[model samples]
Target: MALVGPLLAVVVLTAAPAGVKAGELPWPKWLVAGVVAAAGVLVAVWTPLVKARTDALAARTTREAEREAQAEAALGRLPTLKRKALLVRDMNDRALLGIHEAIPLPTDSDSDNTLSAELPTYVPRDIDADLRAALEARSRTGGFVLLVGPAASGKTRCAYEAIRAVLPHWRLLMPPDGATLNEMVAGDADLKHSVVWLNETQNFLAGEDCLKASMVRRLLADTTKPVILIGTIWPTFYDQLRIRVTTADEESEGGHAFDKDARGILELARRFSLGKWSDQEWDRAKEMQSVDPRIRQASLHRGQTGLTQILSAAPELVHRWEQAETPFGQAAITAAVAARRCNHPENMPIAIIEALAKEFLTDFQRATAKEDWLTDALMWACRPVHHSGGIAPLQAYGKNMGQIDGYRVSDILVDHKSKSAPIPDGQIAPDIWETLAESATPQACLLIGMGAYSAGVLGVARSAWERAANTGNAEAMAPLGVLLHNEGDAEGARTWWQQGADAGNTGAMTALGAMLHDEGDVEGARTWFIRASNAGNANAMTNLAGVLYHQGDTEGARTWWQQAADEGDADGTAALANFLYDQGDTEGARTRWQQAADEGNTQAMANLGVLLANKGDIEGARTFYTRASNAGNANAMTSLGMLLSREGDAEGARALWQQAADEGNTQAMTLLGIALDREGDAEGARALWQQAADEGNTYAMTVLGVALDREGDTEGARALWQQAADEGNDMAAQALRGFIEVEE
Candidate 1:
């Protein structure tokens, strides 16, 4: 109707003359004029706004197209970086890669140049047959193999070598941690033909909630994939797990839970034990005439010989160095013995050893010529290829003596069978300990006590300590306190420690603090630790850090640990190193461990060896483990054995493991048993297994049970299985179930 009004007006205007149309229009003339004016105004106002909006939309589209093109062009030029970044995270990128590409290896010596070549030519020894048998057997029953060894042992190398031989073109996968392992197993569909190796496998099995262990168990139980898993575990850790499994209190609420996990892990895999390189293996290695000539020369050096041979060569070296009848060689021997009596042989500062040598010179009234005595010779013997920050300041300040290598001193004629070596007077110059004790000097008397104590002459040690204590010597008082503490006289220990502490003996103060800490007196311990720390005691600093950590002062604890480590305390370095490792600073952790190990920290040696192995630094790891094992560290011995085995030195590995086993290392005993069985000594193997089982090794018990069954002694097997099953051994339980079925 509105359109009609406008149209009628227009038609009327057009139909009639302009003047007559307005007067004759159907609508009023003014209204028709107003409508037409409004319509013209609306068109004029809206036209510019619509055109501006259209122009903006077109510009935005052009900008977006330009940005897309630029992004595509930039991405095209970054393919290399993009590929590497993506490959780092890609599952496919993990397969068939070399160890060098995955982790950094050591290049300490010329021998490292041939490390890659050595891996391929590496001969396998003890576990070779067993592994081969497992490979064949797994084809039918479908199971994986776990090669167990010590830190420096060649478990990982041997596994890779075997893989290279068996699965030439197959991909090798190494997942760094538990989370990555889980992701790979769960997400990787083409895992069937690939080889996965978890080296230093103990990291996964440790702690209460072992997610890695559980994951491994599940993977083993999964029969769908023919995936081969080769795991290398530290023997000590495996032994610890076995103990937890076999000694579980069945009636306890949580025992079953612990046993179930441990037992399931034990039953899921077949075990092969490896040891250190044997003499024959070493001979064979030399025959390979490695690609590196320097390595061959090093092998020929007297220092590069076996521990026993090196020690035996030492006496000859001394004889050659000191042609005269001077007593300097004997003085060095006495000092070396005293040095080994400290917390560890490496813990004795070079200054102290040098000081002890000076005492011998002064007593002998010899010329004080720096060249006459053994100080230079001793220093040379103690020099390390690597310098360490973890050496005590006194040892490094004036003399700048690197960490002591001990020249394999501990390997010398110590009475291992009887554990009672002759006194210094008998072994070195006559009356050395007696003269020092009779001197009545506090420091001299303390040295006399230490020497006597090391020789198992406790009575002499006590007499020397008492003489010095009677003279009110605080240093002597502290040693007396240590004696009482070792003898289980806690109250006596505290009284002596108190007296020594009052006399300003920092050692006594630390000892008191340790006793108080053990007695649950946290505040008292803190007070003493602070006093000792102020007196410049590295051990006290370490202790203070521990207490602070327990009190929830993590930053304070870290500060104390850093202070201790800076002062060359091995415990401090180890703690700090472990903290860094847990925080994923592997390089930092490695540095600290190396420092601590250089200072004669055996635990640090084992840990450092593990780190080096993970990084593919086999030779470096072996050296640390060897040093630690020579220092009487059982874990190091175990690890070194594995390395030796990897190098096809079965006898060397066995010797190391036997020593460790004698020191009550159950894992060593278990491995020794396997070696015995392999060598056709079934009865010996059974006896060793029995001994281990008696010490609460569930794995040994299970193995023994299987052996008995195989020997047709069903009743004996049933008895063993029943006992093991009651302890929550899954394999034992399964065996019992099968036995019941057969009977029915």
Candidate 2:
């Protein structure tokens, strides 16, 4: 509309003759000139305005095109499938492929065809309803659902069916690794109503960029866009993640510092267990046998093996490896099996297996072996016996880029070996240990050492740790020292600890300081403790506080304790509470103790109970005491028993005292003995007192001495009283003086 006025003015100006002038045409010359000038001004102003609009429109179109291209690229990069577009058959093909790497069944048909090519008819288990319900709830309120079981127990299959049944329209996002999954969650990708499929969940909970508790919290945080994280894991991995690592655990040789984030993440999961098929499930499988040939074949061994195990060809895989036709092939498989047993389970390098295989071969076999023996052996190990699936005794991984990275022994074969019997300690070949020590990564060596240590195989543990320590692994040093200390090699332990401490290993420094303190070198202990504390070791800070407290530096001790507590050390928090309680800060002590108790500190719970009881809050005291006692705190048990006794619940008190005594609580033993004596069971009382006194209980000594004196055994009573008094038991000292006066 703006251009129309300019166009009309140009047309009018062109129509007028230039020579005739404006005056000869319509009106006066001045008016004509004014009209021409007006037309010129309008044309000049409108040209640039139209050009600007044209440029803007073209730029906008270009930007829209670029944005669309970017959206396409992002969609291509995403490891997700839209549920509405996803075909169930494709999902079955990918998700259930190699669900359990079992031995392939021998067949005359094509090797690429196997039972796993098409999933067998589903026989619903008892857990199905509950699992479905959980999945359904996840759709509304986002959550993590973990299915835990052994290998080939149908965990993956069951979880797959449940998702299909309850959340068929939800999108599925399967990240290739933990890092990628973390990226997806942390990125601006739309995760609404997405099912995060994590098969073999341990892989997703490991490594530097693994899925963490904080990431999970973020993933499930917004209720408006719910996400369902469904995963399958072996029971062992789940147990490892669930077990809390304590200070004692951090100090022990076999103890591993579990990933706190991984532990926390598992705690958020709604877990369900899937075990072997029961009689009812088996009956259901029987009814489906006519529909599926695989089911019919698996039903024959229903009692002997799991139905899922049969379908996955677990038994056949075990048999194939055990009865290998070639000696070299058998040796290679055996080496792989041994490597897995020693904790080198995943991505085992081919070079290591090749080196270890020779040790397993017989003298005759080694001498007669061909130049291409290794090549032939590996081929035999990896050959598929099944008609159509990639089923082999030893499955190769990392082959996508042409270079084979490593091979993993079929899980069923490893599972079978584990269930049969563990290879006795020291029975693992020396050559196997030597090869692993020389070739295994430092981290792998540490794991191998821990496994060996837990199995009471000290020699292997020592070898493994030595290898790792030689590689300058500071983490391995303190544990090596712990191994030596446990073996009564104090000098060796001190030597390793000194080396480790010099290497700036905080654990080693803390451990060395503890040893020095135990040997009566308080100043030396304090020095190392300070160094470790300065290095940001929380345990060291707690130890430093204790040293300062013993040195009568109460203010200094409190400072270190506060620092440790701030670092989230539960022991430090509990210790700080104790300090506050001693300083008569009742409210502060109660607050700190409550914090520690909530963090799973049993001692804090017992101490809190005592404080409540002193304040005449008996019911509150009982609650804390019961909580602590149920968590296996013997001290809490004894205290609760005393509380019960005061409340006139004699039977309950005696039962709690007996439980505490059984757990080696000497105070409980002494108290129970007195009760037994009152109940007219003199012999039981004497036995209890003797046991407690043997364990160095001074009160038990005094009681036992009085009982002996009453029975006319003056000499025995005198000996007991003298022993207890020498140990600084004041009651025993007074009892002895009175006894002497009576004798005189």
Candidate 3:
């Protein structure tokens, strides 16, 4: 427009002078000038190129101004809750797609060139990296993950972490306390790529079919938008794949409610996440005999289908768990034992509670026996936080909580010497260790690893107990004896064991009996064993029965074995299985073997694995055989080798048998010798057979005898046969008889 005005003025000036000269009766000077000006303006008006360029310039100028204004507005809106009111909201954009609503596109005004430099953006919170990447790839893919916790255990905070991670560019959406569900999904379009975090969601769901609840139902049902529900309680969002983040109750609630909340935490620990033990802040859950008798024998394992139960009926257990550390893995072990106990009440007689406890200890192998004591201490420490609805969670501190039931949360936090930042290392160690020593002597500090406490714990189990014994406590003497025995000082163990037994410590009586047996003092062993056995030391009875059997006291052996088995010893069960197998009770033997195998005895596992295989349970056999191999069962190794060979893996089979042979397993050595022979290594096979024969393997002796006979040493072969015959090899006896008959 500026260019045209100047050009027109110049033309009008030049044309006005010319018009006066060219026209006879030219119009007035002013009129002629105006006419010339109008002609100059018309000159460019009809030119297509000029008009097109002019329109383009005008449009560009308008857009530039609009963009600058938009950027300024966005800068003004920086870091506020509501998004900059998109004044340029495009009506052309579609509202909804297939299931999810379409997120609107940024307008031209959002052009970076015009974006205000003053706008400061907030970054997303750092969180679980893998989940972050997945969400980014899917463009705000929305799904439900169950977030369960005892009240105030930080369930809400975790949900916020997920939301903050995914929506880095957006401002935080911290809904006011007691917000309606409608407010939650109100910004549906923006939240399509963001999360609608509903805090205290349970209260929103309290009255069903209400306007707020209806909004919640619709939002969840939409499935395309990410929605997070944070509540003090549990929720049900159906027909969706979900993840559960379970937690324990915060230290706030007092009285039975707090205890009940702790119980719920235990239930979540035991029932979810694959039955592994999870330590809560201040509680321990372990398997113990249930007060109810009917439940005592029940075989139903908890947490088998973990998240499944959580998504369905998890709310029921929210308040009943009382133990600090819930034994989650116990249920599976309990079920496994219950089935066996019910089936073979005599041979396989471990009660569900006993088996479950054994399973608990076995599963956590790296954990110490003193760790159990720690569990009890933690439970006592958890004793309900006294304050509720406080701004901060309570912290336990100081020498005297003074019967602390409930105190000011801030008082608890500030009262400690360290100002409640976590008890100082110097103080916590001494305090916990000192308090622990009251019940657990320093020598047996369960959770204390090798450190400053190592002197008190690992190397002092006996010394600490000795002081107790010197103070005239016989029970302490019993533990000292066990410690001495474990240290390989049998004489010292005997001394304490006798003292403790004279004081009527039954555990000491068993130790004395065991030491006597090891010393080849059978009469003394028998007397102590009787005392221990009568006191219900099943270990004593089992050991005594083995000795009786060796002495040809079959009736006495049977009596003790029955007594031990009835008391639930896996060893006793295996012994009974051996006897039954000899008596032609194959079914009874298999059942007993299976029972013993469940107790983690390698020999029983190998026996069961072999028997199950012969009975044509190939898959079950393979699985068992693998377990047995893991347990270092040599027979299982040889059996697995043959199975693998049949499956066309001869080399693999050879490697397995060789491993067992390397472990000095007689059966494995014998089988490896056979495998070597089959592979055309006769000398190597003979060498292996020699090793096995020297180990008193009768089958190996027969193989050696045959090898000697083949080498043209008939007398040497006969000698080998005689040795095998002495070891009860029927084939060897027949071979010797046949040779004698032939010679006669």
Candidate 4:
């Protein structure tokens, strides 16, 4: 029985992993030998020891097998659309009718009537546009994109948009969420090769939910697919963000300046969406501005102020039918909507509203069965939106918080009258999950709700990390340490880091090493870094070289930097270029930088462009700089701004520089200061230069010193020049000595 038990356990355990080939696993040998050994040990003096060793070996084997399985799973990810494409191609099937099979049919009532409530196709997909573009590019070439956006800033919208765009390429196997971000990134997609956009990048990064980072880092190594990460960070978060800024003034200025008061959402909305508001409508909207600014300003269609987002997003029938003209008109509609909602709360879903407003005369609607589409839309709209940050829970009806109890609508209304619950709670629970999970099959219907809650909670899970860490789980430790590291609690993260590292957690080792290095513990960091590097953590190797370089270990830095460069760190390439240039190997530096520039490092492009321009390769420089500018490089913006200003677009150039300065670019500020001074606003120039100098800019110091000298503040100018000179500014130092008459 004991021998049989061992064989059964091995067979059972192996089944979960690639199913052990029949007889391939030495089940009988191990089982019989283990049983005989156990009996002998029991008869002697080591039953406990033998059992412990056996169990430990079994556990390790299981873990190793699980690890390999997870790695394989990680390698298999693809977004939803691409998966469909791959399926179609591989199976020699062309029919896409199966896609809609996942959407549910309404059981309580006819879904046709509800299909009227989804956002119209015309609803702006800008939130999704960038990523969708990236995703499409990735379909053929492959790459990964990191998308960042504020809560409700629409990361998922972008994901869906990409799905729609890549619908035609059904031959590519893209899973709904993609196989893995790492797998996507391995393609080396950029503007040229692939469209790789990540939505809600924080969720896709160093978090328990995101296991794709390793593979993504691997994808990042690809030269063919360059990825752009899009996200929205809180202002403070953005402040902490580090970007290598080096644009021309004109391109850098206008958009990102730090004014005391930011442009409010209402103001931005008005600018972007209400520009098409009619004269009378605008006046009416102004007249109807309520005492309550929150309500009046918050709604996209407050009063008659702008094109009714409701009307704009509405299907032609509703647009023509519902006219919310005066305070009376809006009030009437609100009253009607509210009255019916209270009366027929059951049908008051936003999906119905959206469906009612969308273009209904389309065959696509027919194909998906409007009923199924409406059912899907309703569920999607009704779902809790946790990532909208602090946005009030979106009501199932409209942007306004009216439930027929709050207001009413005058337009075509369906009374959602319900006297009592229609079914038992258990019945409805399964129904809800079944309807919703139908759209995505990976989640089991019975387990649908549990899966979603688990996914969401796991996505941000951290409180449970310590427990998981104590239990020796690597995934939990890697991200918890990362979180601590990010929070500036490096020491607090160390214990877990060591535990995880010992357990083979690559991310923990990399993170811990980075933390130690950052705190000036180079030797301690190097040991951890080496372990991570050996374990295939590219970031660790790159960071190790950086630490070495900073400590002036030239040869050590070079050797490690080569490892990082081989593994694809643009920073490694840039650093090597600078190092070579500093060592007087200009030709090598230029060539190396040109290669990096070709890989879409905006800074490299700008640097190479500047180099080429200085060497009179103006056309080539322009080409490279233009690409860099388009990628949102502030330095390139500033450079382009300067180039444009030289060509006489002074105002435009000034505008660009203004943006860069706002984003805290001191270099751009210095340039803008000079431009203003040249334009006769000496005081403005002085103010800007002072700000830049305060930001630790030596160039700004030189400019301020020069300006102060020109303004006749000779002593102050001398002090400024001396500061700049101390930082190796030859011009400032030369002028300082000459002005002081201290040097022959």
Candidate 5:
């Protein structure tokens, strides 16, 4: 098109020359020059336009090809797209499926057995309504829905059915591990209207290459590309991940830092907890017995066991363990159960299990055991009880990882055994504890100790910690010392603390210093506190400040308190607030107290209430006092009681005072005594006053002395007054002077 104008100009010039003399002008020179320049302009404008159109066509074609490739890759990444019902049936084959597969029913040769192979009909759970609502919300805006429950409680099945009902056609992208999940999320895969299937969510949220909270947040934030992240987790893992890290825990040597990303991701989830099947759900299952033989068999055990558990072959697994033919196999299974009961890790090392098995065998069985007893035990324990899908009592894992191969006891069996008796605590043999302590890894021992401590199995905790501490686990030492101190073995606690401090554990140093300070070794406490504070322990800095303040180093105390408070220590912040209040910085004190109280410091809440009350903000004071009192702050209770009494709510005041007094608050006891006296319970008031006075409450002593003087026990009153005055009680001193003058 650009050449057309130029070619036409040439033709016109040639024709003009033919009609006229050669080299003679056909028109004025200006007209000729203008015509040629116009053709040049057309050529210059049209050439780039043509090139641009060609380039655009090529780019469009390339984009189409890339889109095609991406579509194929996305399809490859998500191979599990099918009808919702078919997907539900297919999920039965998944080993890590949170819902256990049902045990098959027996079929006779001539029976109408068309439904023999099918899974039991899905009985709707009580939590299904809420689960479905969350899944439905995912379609409008992306969401993460997590179902937490015990093993085989059907959490996964509920989530699966909910998604099936809501987003049935959305492609399911089931990543094999956390790394793959992270990559799939981070990649440029078109995840719109897709379901990210995470069956055992802990596998994705924990360990290396775990899915990050930020990634999930980014995914959900994009409304244009909504994707449903649905997963199931055990209650234990959910609790473990979502645990808040306390200030003390953060500063402790053995304490764990919160798994922030895991917790954050969990927090974003619309969580549903599934419990045992309700009687209604079981009745629903019974109504469907005619449809599936498996449901019929499971229904027979409705009153005896959980219908879900029965459907999931929990009984069959238990039978397999209890009715093993070989003694060696039974012993091995029993040992594994015992280990699990003792809070041992799920992945029990093969060697540890084999060694522990011998203890379970009778003397005759042990003596008659074959050379290949372990081999036989492994085969028996690892063999699947059902023809398909159902798990064994013990399943061997970690085949490829050298030195990490072990057996995982079925959680169903563990739960079943636990229901029969208290686990890992009550009546557990000492030998089992000894064996576990001796055979388990230091990390495993630490975990066992924690579990035992939480369960109040102090003996087990002591044993586990002793083993862990013996293995040079510095983090174990401080906790061991604490356990010892709690058990009244102060000398033993000191020894372990010394060992931990020697290993450079700042928590242990702080703990030892606090203990020494309590025991009147001020210089020794000071030395350890200085070491820990220098090592960047905020708790130590706060404790050191308290010691310094007591030792008359006021400025030094202030400096250390400031440093600790700057590091976000709630105790230090509260202490600094107190110091500022003493220094007449009321506003500064209030600011620090507010900061500390916001951090969940109960004492700070109580103190802040006091400050507010002093400023005549009674309502504001009551709000804080109520908050602190509900958190079990006895001092707050006392203050709140006083406010209520002034407001003429004597009943409310008495309630609070009695509760505080029961918690051994001396001020509460004294105040309650006064209230009792006003109520005409003079004997009760005197009894309370005597108790408070015995606790060294000077006010209680003076009040009780006045009561005794009224009762004509002048000597008793005089003695109480003299004792209170010796403790620098000004009111008691004046009363004693008056009593002495009257006696003269």
Candidate 6:
């Protein structure tokens, strides 16, 4: 009956649809309940999926924040060489087979090549005789010797002569480069008593070779053994090496080269210069060449004039090779030219040469394999280089422009005037500046600007810097600000630095902090200093520590200083040592000072000398003071003089004081005057005393006053004595009172 009623209602609605509207048709309540239950099921299924996605997004955001925090922490820490130890150690694992392949063993006619039993005849120069004696003396104690000279200056011959005289029974072991040398030392027990000679030693001493520094450290460490390490260097290469000079005098005096890497080498080695052959030596060399076959073969071109000719032929030979029709020669010449232009010598990696060949000599003949092409290139470069083995081994290569596999050309051929040492008042040519401004990249302009700055060409530097700064490159920011500051635009400098700081430049932040500190806005300086320090500026870390210490946060300051020292900052090490000394940790301070001194921190060297002297280690103190004084530390000169005087070497003390006075040290002037007075040089003593007195030295004033009184210059004596007494000089007071009594 229900089916029949529903059917009847549907039929009625369908029949009335054309003209009739009907009210709600109600049949059953069960249909409506079923629809509502289905909708609830759909809602239930979607809820968990949405919640899962939300949870995943939240977890991802948390992980990103944690990663950002870790990144910041890593950025805050300073770069250290600690990580390089493992890398340097691993470099020693390279096989030794390829290293010594460059320089073949000496060969005789149709016989196997071997070191000669007969002593190599050498035309004995003063330096050669000294080297020979020194080598013989240190043969049993594993001392280092550096033979530095110009190209073809017979340095290698000197090495051979020295080794033959010193270690006649010992085998000659010449590993190709620093890495192989280190490997040989580590793996071969026989090297303990052997003569290890490294020729063209600049290859090893370049800063990119960490293994070389490591090798020097190891050689210096075990000096008790009978191993002798000798190396020959080009004079130009030696000049290019980093020297840690702390004072203006040191720079002016052409400072001693003992950077972080070179320090160990310098400490262990006694340096000897092989001068160009004198006219007498050259004549003697001709006579020796007739008697000695070794000398005859080594000196094929004869003396210094012939050697210079051979060296000058390098670029000409390269040009000739380039002008040749053959692709191999052209490719070789191109690579050599590229290397020369880049200022890298003989340190070109094979792979880099090949890459360059591929780029520059794409259509070259394929008559030889790619390897032969590189060999040909080196073979051509070596043609004009006398006394050099025909080909450089792969190990001779070093980073070019900091690229691992790049190649360097022979430096002898390159026109060096363009890269000459900057003259203090040098001016860049108008054409040079125009070319640089017109064609150079932004980065290149910045480098040009730096060069100008170094050469004291301020106008050119400003122009270049302005050009670079307009590009909005971040590196130019702080340097431009520095130029502005130097030009007396303090507010402009601050504005530029602030802008750079806002752009996240740590250098600019440091510059701002330094300026503020100089201006006595210490609180503002601290804020900028902290920001730069947290961004991993080593200078800023030291600056922050200084400000913190000034503000009485001693512990916090100590923490920052320790952080800086751990990062291997020389200044930071010195500062930390001072802090430790203040805190009564003398031993700790000594350890830190030693570390800093070894790194060539001039202040640390002077400080270490003082500390060692206090500890009754006079010899150690003398060593440090001599090193610091050589680096032009006036304080060290004065201290060293005092020590020499204490040891009864008055002449030596006086000489050091004279040197210090020449460097504008008032204390040295006063002391030297006293020494001169004792030596009965009354006029010289008076002049020095007068100069020192003018510089506000109380002792000098009193001494000068007494000398003037003795010389009958009563008015001058009275004035000098009165001024000195006013400055709290007891001697001056006594002298002044004596003059007053005499006047009465």
Off by over 4 Å in 4: 1-473, 476-503, 583-599, 742-744
In candidate 4, what are the lDDT values of residues 561-605, reduced to their tens digit?
A: 566556554545655665666566768878867765654556667
TM-score of every candidate: 0.37, 0.62, 0.43, 0.44, 0.60, 0.47
Question: What ranges in model 5 sit over 4 Å off?
Answer: 1-148, 154-272, 278-312, 355-371, 399-404, 418-431, 438-443, 520-538, 544-633, 636-662, 675-691, 708-744
Shift in Å, residue 341, candidate 3: 36
Model 4 residue 168 CA deviation (Å) reads 21
Show how many residue pairs clash in every candidate, following the order shown. Answer: 16, 6, 15, 102, 0, 2
Cα error of candidate 5 at position 81, Å: 19
Candidate models: Cα lDDT each: 0.53, 0.68, 0.43, 0.43, 0.68, 0.55
Residue 427's lDDT within candidate 4 is 24
- Name the weakest run of 10 consecutive residues (lDDT summed) in model 6: 34-43
Task: Give the TM-score comparing model 6 with the true structure, all chains together.
Answer: 0.47
* Residue lDDT tens for model 5, 164-204: 78877676677665656544544545678888888878767
On residues 50-108, what C-alpha lDDT tens digit does candidate 1 reach at each position? 34335545765775565455434433332233353222123222123222111112245
The C-alpha RMSD of each candidate to the native structure, in angstroms, is: 33.4, 28.8, 40.0, 24.2, 27.9, 30.4
lDDT of 2 by residue, 192-300 (tens): 8888878888767753345655457667867889999988887766765554432342421112233445665776789999877799999999998766666777898
Off by over 4 Å in 3: 1-483, 551-556, 646-648, 680-683, 738-744
> How many backbone collisions does model 6 have?
2
Give the TM-score ranking, best first.
Answer: 2, 5, 6, 4, 3, 1
Q: What digit string (tens of lDDT, one per residue) describes model 3 on residues 1-744?
A: 000110011011110001111111121121121111100000000111234335545765775565455435433432332454221121111111001111111233333343222211111222235444544544444433334433322334434444455655533333332233343343332344334334433332211111232234334445465543323333211100021111111111110010121122112211111122133211111131132221121213233322212211122222111122334322222222222111111111122222333333444642544545433432333343222211222123334556422211211111122232232221333333322323332222211221212233434334445655765667566656655655677688778879988887655776676566556676676676666666555556666666665555656666766776655455666666655664568798778777766644455665565566556776877887788777666556766776686677778777877987887667567667766766678889889999988877766776677667767888987898899888656556766776677678
Over 4 Å off, model 2: 1-98, 101-123, 132-146, 159-232, 236-271, 283-301, 355-371, 398-402, 418-443, 489-601, 604-632, 640-744
Distance from true position, residue 252, model 5, in Å? 17
